[model samples]
Target: MSAPGEKVTIARKQKKLTQTELGDNVGTSRDIIGKYERDETKPSIEVAAKIADVLDCSLDYLIKDINPEDELAKKIEQLSPINKEYVMAVIEAFEAKEKLQGKR
Candidate 1:
């Protein structure tokens, strides 16, 4: 896995956030965000936790070499309840399709 800064860059981009936007949400300046993204400076654990929350990712993904998707449940936690059910249904449909193909 890359450094926490790389993970931050990836996740921030995935969220379609600019450094300034992320900084605004994370309570920092854009320059600080840039420093973090460039790996010139690391955020404190408290700031990192805030960043993770703003990015809708896990602190483990940022600091401990864990994948952000490892917290899949957290990823979908922001979805509406009905949307969450729809997501589950879609996963079930794909699994069922895979099973059918295997059986064939």
Candidate 2:
């Protein structure tokens, strides 16, 4: 499994954010962000949380050894109430269809 720092680096890059930009958002310096990316240093829990916020990812995703589906669930958790309901409904529909087709 990748380390928390590595997860942060990957998520930041996937979001198209530079180290400097991420640092600016997280109230840190580019050098510090670079260090984190290089796995030479670890951020404080608060700073890590801020980084996750800036990267639009869950803290679990950055720090825990979870699968991609867990990450997707985390993303869905951030949706608005109505959107959350809609997404859940869609997922349930798909699951029901799959069950009917003996695909599960």
The lDDT for every candidate, in the order shown, is 0.90, 0.92
User: Model 1, poorest ten-residue lDDT window?
Assistant: 64-73
lDDT of 1 by residue, 15-59 (tens): 999999999998999999999988999999999999999999878
Which pairs clash (backbone N, Cα, C closer than 3 Å) in model 1?
none
lDDT of 1 at 83: 95
lDDT score, candidate 2: 0.92
RMSD (Å) of each candidate, 1 decimal? 7.1, 6.9
Relative to the true structure, candidate 2 reaches a TM of: 0.65
Q: For model 2, what is the error of residue 16's alpha carbon versus the real structure, in angstroms, after optimal superposition?
A: 0.7
Q: All candidates' TM-scores?
A: 0.65, 0.65
RMSD of 1: 7.1
Candidate 2 structure quality by residue, lDDT tens digits, 1-104 = 88878898899999999999999999999999999988899899999999989999898888888888876888999999999999989999999999999999
